[model samples]
Target: MEEGKEDLETLGEQLYNRIYPSHKEIAGKLTGMLLELPGSVLIQMLQDESVLTGALEKALKALQLEQEPRLTNKNEDEVSVSSDSVGEQLFDLVDVYNTGYSQKITGMLLEQHKDAVLHLLSDPKLLEEQVNLALKTLKEQSVEETDVSDSSDTDDTERLGERLFSLVEQLDVLHANDITGMLLEMDPADLQQMLGDGAMLEAAVRKAQAALKTWN
Candidate 1:
């Protein structure tokens, strides 16, 4: 019951975080049935190239990824089960033909740029060397160029808060760490600088961390 539902939500969260977007499509697009299946069965299919049950295959194909290979039966002595991985049959082939890169490459991009890669997945022409440059661009883009007409300290606080929130909304834990490290490495000035107070910036960072958890 209640515990089981909680457990499934946790599993869905973990699976959603660890599974690539494409593999997710291969797994019934995060359907409840996928979560309801035995962990051993899902693990078996993910790890080894096993024949998926009919319901599972149909569920995966419902998403209509480009290269879902026809499934074979284990009982057929003349035909061997698909040696290609469930991921390979679904996502990897699409990776080859569509993106021409692996999830590993995209994952490395995440390590470099946090959740930014999630947006970049649509760009098939992306190159690995361009990752850091994209991050710098995004970081710069976070700093809005608008002029605040109010000359009060309140306007300063609001403006700084807006800039910081803009950055955090795009960040995950890793990218937050990047900002933390950058902040720490820089010298400070006064209460009227960086933000209204150190506590405010700390609160913004915490908000980004909390937001990242929900994104999973």
Candidate 2:
């Protein structure tokens, strides 16, 4: 009986080393599972190396599958938290000079060039360049859309103004009123141009947002 027990322990050690040479805890668990089999089954496994290895491989695969979602979710959560922290740091840097435009600019950079924003977080100069590039793009878009024509009536213009106000609010609610007031101060024709054309209105709001600090 003692000899039989020693043989079982020896077989368990060999199985553990063969299956998980570098992971003692995992190997021990697998070895325990293997040892739980009936004497006849254990004897067959002990007789055929392929049978023991095959059973271990199947158990390991099932363990991996069971753990996949949990591992994936943990990694995803870590990445999300890391990304938000990086984004906030970048936003504060951009906000120093740009003020209210920081959120919009940072959001644009993340959307258009996410890899750069995340990977270059340590390089403030490069991040500033990215912010400048995003601002330049917004300016160019605004310039392109500024050529819109307007022929709407007073009521149509009022409705358009309300819609434009709402759109600008979506950019940053805290400064929406101030930005809308700034837009209101534009020349009658320019204001009409923005209100009448959706693209023009969006571009105008973005332009106004970028230039918001200058007027302050």
Candidate 3:
């Protein structure tokens, strides 16, 4: 996994060097954004040059947006209350779901419905509908480029480990391998239960992270 991250960082550097030579310093930041993409998406990006270029461009643009203010003072003042409320809800959407692609998918949904974020947040059913729509859109966007359906080759344990690893990575826990190792060491039934329960998995991850922090 660490090796994979290194390869992504290397690719990110190459991407920035090729297209944004003048902004070389931001390459690392762009690379971090690229890492936020699901592992499958990253692999697809590597196999397809067009996909790679497009993803890199999006990362670059995202970085640029962060460095510049998109709204004027008047606009900020007008939306301050709603933005604050909506922003919290958006964050809850991201943090509540342990799905590996929540961050990327949420960003895509926001981009597609910039003006409707507050409106969507107003109703629970509407918010869920939009989120599902975003998830479907993402799956459709990558369905042709990536085939995630096949896993007949790996045993159930291997598949379980892969799923757990992906979820742990999304947690952004320090020493993720340590947490994964702890989870993997559980009784087979217990491990399977945790894997099926996102809330339990998240709680375990947080507990592990806290313990590791204290010990270190």
The global C-alpha lDDT for each of the candidates, from Candidate 1 onward, is 0.40, 0.57, 0.56
What TM-score does each of the candidates earn? Answer: 0.22, 0.32, 0.32
Ranking of all predicted structures according to lDDT, beginning with the best and ending with the worst: 2, 3, 1
Winner of 2 and 3 under lDDT: 2
Candidate 2: residue pairs that collide: none
Screening candidate 3 with a backbone cut-off below 3 angstroms (N, C-alpha, C), the clashing residue pairs are: none
lDDT of 3 at 190: 77
Better TM-score candidate (1, 2) = 2
Candidate 2 regions with alpha-carbon error over 4 angstroms: 1-83, 112-115, 149-216
Worst-scoring 10-residue span by lDDT in model 2: 63-72
lDDT of 2 by residue, 36-103 (tens): 54456666776788777666665554344334332134566454433344445555555533323555
Q: How much does candidate 2 score in TM-score? A: 0.32
Q: Distance (Å) between predicted and true CA of 65, model 1?
A: 22
| Model 3 regions lying over 4 Å from their true place | 1-23, 70-216
